[model samples]
Target chain A: MRLFLLAAAVFALPVTALAQEADAPLELPPVVMSTEHPGEVAVEPYDRSNAHAGATPFEGTAMLEAFHGVEGIGRVVDAMIDLSIEDPRIAGTFVSHDMVRLRRVLKEQFAYILGAPVDYSGRDMATSHRDIGLQAADMGALVENLQIAMDREGVDFRAQNRFLAKLAPMKDDVVTR
Target chain B: MRHCQSIGVVASLIVATLAGPASAQMFDWVPESRAGGKLLLTGGVSTIEGSGGGGLATWAVTSGYGAEDGIGGNVHATYVNLPDYELRSWGAAASFWDRVEVSVARQEFDTGATGALLGLGSGFTFTQDIVGVKVKVLGDAVYDQDSWLPQVAVGVQHKSNDQGAIIAAVGGRDDEGTEVYVAATKLFLAQSLLVSGAVRWTDANQTGLLGFGGDRNDDVEPQFEGSVGYLLNRNLVVGAEYRTKPDNLGFAGEDDWFDVYAAYALNRHLSVTAAWVDLGSIATFEDQRGLYLSLQVGF
Candidate 1:
């Protein structure tokens, strides 16, 4: 009876632990050799710069105000990422990826590009998407999701297009396939 | 009994681990089968001549919502009601990989009371068929925002008019001909504007409804088409187009075509276009101006 109990306990151990892990936040533990954002997985070491945002920021705060500042930018990024992760055309690209870090970096990148008070600290576009094998169609899917997210945020259509124009040049770097 | 329990526990542990990874594998990154990915209005509306473009000018954009990894096609019907004549056309176009486009169209030019005045009976109709192919040569109009270079394409259109006797009576040299063109298109997203231009070499008189070449001019001449559009929103674009036509027939003068137009996408699969167009004159009838309406359905 004791031996059976011991075996049962052994079997229950990892299962219980896995259930707990599933309930916990998905942030991975940081690696020892890299700069880490809170609640984000460690990434390979690379020089980080605002230039990693891949586009020049607008000249004035009007664009930032149109996006409702960094807070709105955060919401937009989160919604866009969530939609894209759920979209059948593009959800596969987000699978098994470190979404926590992606959400944070995308928020920063969008805030910086919209002329908000933020600096992007992420890898450049080409380096970040190096292995994703994104085609023009994939990029188009993401853009559609982003548009929906922005529309939900009540951003003016013209303002949204102006913002998209700034990001459009990065297609060369993002669509490697 | 203890040995059995131990083995069962080992198996359960193995199952748990395998199941964890399997759940993580719920969504696999399948590399194939992506479609319907082009942005709204990026494909442009079908033209009267059966290519993708503004109402009159042929832009370099392909025919449908297909992106580089997919296929898209559409069918369109257009009608132009002029003062002295009515023109109707229906066509279909398909795009592959956003690289190649194939299209076919049929046009009917009907002269109402003007046919009786010209002594060709009342309600005379000239029918023509066009088949065209366009290949995207380089660049992307929508995505390449940093560059001034526009998306460019080369195309050929073969036209056959059915009224051979009437064409010869109008001093036409042939009832069939071929036209070649090069087109460039660009979208300035910041300015919410799109621009396109094409140069066509053709001897087709009145776009081949009156037939190809003529007694006065039997040589194909270069003609220009230009369009400029401003995007009002994601689904609406307002533009103007100008197209120069060859005056090959000695018996009648041909005039350039122009239109101020608006195109709206009801969704990715459907769109409508309306314009006020001026075709100047048809045959000996002068001041042919009226409404142009077109309907397109596709994906």
Candidate 2:
């Protein structure tokens, strides 16, 4: 009888302690959302369908992936270079002797847009453009060309604007004649 | 028999401890009966008055602490961008026992003005220090689930412009004046909307630290502020807001304005927001529209 009572008390101790701790405020787990594809759905109660049903779809990760991959990046880079060459204004502003530097800038920008792991280590945009003499007209043209490139890749307008917001602050630095 | 008595005594003591002041104090912070401890961050741009006038479009970051029932506080920093000058302000606030809030802020306006206006060459700067207090007189915006009336609060911001020479040159009356205001704010949880309206009574000429001169009677004018947001998930909110201001200064006409904004809660510790503002013209200054963006990280 004595042994059974002792065993019962020992067993009850952990349960009671757990009950008290459970009553306290437990830390909430970090919420993670799916980034696999634009159409992928998350499981509920982790689902945000009702809350974010109206959100602009996620496109940055996929776009970044396309830039990182050899074939996709090659095609996009060729198109960008071809467009720049065809447009004298773009050619004047983007005049670079180092193809490697240009490629690296493009890669860094893609990574930023895709929320990937990358840091931009290029020359300061303002200092580089100090001698180029870009006007508002040139800025407008650059936006248009970027828009065309985004459209070719099926990027939505809102998502494109989100990306542009990150780049807009550079205007102050880049447009100083 | 002695062991049983000892167990009984221990149980009684535990029950007594559970019913003591410690437990009661814990309950006070639990946010029960109130939607407490919500950290709110907000900013917008508008004309200082209701007509066409050029005022600084502002971007601010603020964070609220504690519960609606108990003591709460907030700290904010603002940057105002103008055509010729830039103003920066930092402030801290405290709300005591959930009934009163007191705040203090310091401002610096630098124009880098050279060869302009009264031999006050480049590096001409204007500074102001403001002290504010607010009291919640009636109504609750969040917890009174059955009512439509929002949380109504009355507050005052007293400003002391440090530019004594400018005030003297402009023939201003007092370097210090109080702006007393009443505001009503509501949160529509279902629609993810926040609406607010306010009226301010003040003697200060402009919302800017530069005191308004001339024969202007201390008058009360109605100001309105409202926001409608769409929750793009729990972490992201896309919204718009419109706020009105009193045209205390007669130099330029003040016109109210509106903004479209989007905010993403990166986590509990960080948030990023962007806004497109259409600030109505100040007097002859048309197209006072611009973009405002801000990022906030908190613990």
Candidate 3:
């Protein structure tokens, strides 16, 4: 039926933006199993095995350098705080707070987390914000602000996700509400 | 009447998709502990052979992007119009925790004019039902993006043909058999690419159309299926698949299956896939190539 054929149009639109006619082909990595003779599965946790002793970093620290420097960290903090307060979900919470202190503390915290050079002497995050009456929405707003800040800082998507993955674990300890 | 019914089903599906969930609440059901519906197009569309894959190969991904302890599923209807035959199938599958998946599909293979030439009644149809289950064995295809680890799974498909009498008359060994396969799938997020490979031990003739095994070869053999997918965008996937099949019945030669497809996920709830499929030959017909279209809706 003509009606059925019409559904194909969805893919036809913006044809020019799709991948090129030819794409780079993918090849399967070589097999590493029983070459001539091997054995069965005696699997254990990697950390409990001898392989754990040889832990090595596959990548370098050059990626974290983007969030380095006083100017970069300042801009990053400014973007995060500015957007966080501007977000309606969290705006009321920051109204009576000292903006200067929050900014300084956040900068120090981020610097510490990213392994940059900064001295932050604020109470631990969980203890400091425990009475703020934060909700899931507030945490979401914070993540949104952080992601937007990373984008404004020209951090590529992959790098942003990588950094976020490291920071993502803090949600459990920070959000008791 | 059946044609009208099928169309009505599709029409109702479209309405349900539009009225169901707004984009903001798409992943709201997932717990805050895990990010669900974050992976882009991880669940490849249902294949012609009634499993979750590109066109023929089965990927290790458990059919959806639902995170740990979450659930996901979809319903799909596919129609393939080839030069010598027409095929249509309806199926549904669900994945839990991205670990286990179960699916069922009913396939109709219409041997139109070719049926009369072979002394069968006009529009002779070969029908079959396929039920499949797969369990993820290892690795994370998406989250482990920085590593070379690929997700792997082992699965089984039990297929039953309705035309047992006619199938045996064509020299087929049986009308029911199970296919065992192991598949590995990997997603390279940075490169926006996905690759999958599968090895299946089967003796089904033309995927159990004429039936399983035959006078020519009765032993089970290893066949290969492979696929490569390119993420044109977060919602769009273009891929190609290749599946080498078994040649059981000496009545006709079976060629490998190939297809190039583009799958578009309008949102987390609805998707459509269209492809050009080539299932080389069937019976005495040669070059049975055609177009395939499928639609899927789910959370």
Candidate 4:
């Protein structure tokens, strides 16, 4: 039957590819269309894990609720991005970058780290910022913008600091230049 | 060649005038237009010794609002009214790249009416000048929150007193000396607390205003300075400081200093600090407690 022929071909495809890989190396393109997020571009496929969030999530739902759940996290991320793109000190760094992807990944990262019931699918810090040419002062400017966003969302100062403490260590991986 | 030299001199003069009075020709070296990216109060207020810190202790922070890429500077004036003496200090400090600090301070310690009682006449004053350089050697206190390691710095201060004859007559061995210190500071953001400690090696009596070394001690000794601060808000911090001093003078015993202070930043460019200080003993006078007030302004 035609269905049996199709199934046989589907099973044989992987065997053919494995035989080719044994004979030579596969040359994968560096960037490709993101099959997971249609509108975003992605690098060569990698595993998706909560470890990509860079910091461990808080133990309970208290931190999540303090940030007003996922909605508040989304607002803070958007505002931080908007402010950073306009801020003269670091605006140039954001130019020509994939902001669409940045916004989604950042929102997911923040929500996941704040103890939301969500997993991050973004690249690790070192991989994402490898070519940004960032400096220590650029990180400072970003933190300032983030603080402004959190302040506007009515987050308590102590709670804000607790979250900042989590992200502080990521500077080692984020500031490559 | 003479004509070309004259033209070059004229061009330099014009550029200097356009750069303003405070920073003439500085633009020639610094082309970066941006300045002041640091968070508020992160530079700390100017210390009595003109370094960045609390009232009596020198912290590991740089002296200004400059970020890691820019430059910042400040000038401060401090006055202390004590039971037996009055102390006035004024100074300026500049931080470059938030890595190195240079500062200069002048202290005038007036005997006031106590001068007459000590047979030195009224208003007899001892003056001293201190030049200091501090270089940050390790982590950052503000940003490195996840680690227990603190920001550390090492500094040297050279001090010279004007009254060498009076110092020698009072059992002091020298009027000029140098001090070296290492300071460590940390900010526990989760608790809104800051802690700083320092150890200085010196033989100065009364912080070199009464001169260095003395008949009783001529060797450099290590003394400790510590501070603890609690942040009430973004603009306000309350703290206490304790500093130990060497008892090098045979004529009078030197005691440790203590202060409880409050510092408030009105904005990025201006701040005020007030404290109740206990200087312990000066000369033969004891229980020398007083009010301390200081004002700082910068970029």
Between prediction 2 and prediction 3, which has the larger TM-score? 3
Ranking by DockQ: 1, 4, 3, 2
lDDT of 1 by residue, B1-299 (tens): 23533543464354334333342242244344344669998999999888999989999999987788777777787889999999988777888889999998888888878889988889888889899999999999998888899999999999999899999998999999999999999998888999999999999898899999999999999999999999988889999999999998888999999999999998777799999999997898999899999988777
Q: Residue B108: error of model 4 in Å?
A: 1.5
Candidate 3: docking tier: incorrect
Candidate 3 lDDT over B29-113, as tens digits, reads 6554222343446777777665678856798887754545456666777899988788888777777767888887778888888
> Residue-wise lDDT of candidate 1 within A1-177, one digit each (tens)?
001122244456677777775666434333332255665545556787998889999999989998888888889999999899898778878765667777888898999999987889888888888778888888998998899999889898889989999888898888877
- The candidates' DockQ values read 0.56, 0.01, 0.05, 0.38
Native interface contact recovery, model 4: 0.55
Q: What does candidate 4's lDDT look like per residue over B231-269, in tens digits?
A: 877788999999999999988999999999999988667
CAPRI tier of model 1: medium
When 3 and 4 are scored with lDDT, the better candidate is 4
Worst 10 residues of 3 chain B by lDDT: B31-40
lDDT of 2 by residue, A1-177 (tens): 001122234456667777875566533333333354232222233221211111122244654554444344445555665576577545655442234445555554445445654444344555445666655335534654664665566555455445444444455555553
User: TM-score, each model?
Assistant: 0.85, 0.47, 0.66, 0.83
RMSD of 1: 14.4
Give the poorly placed runs of model 1, Cα more than 4 Å off: A1-36, B1-33
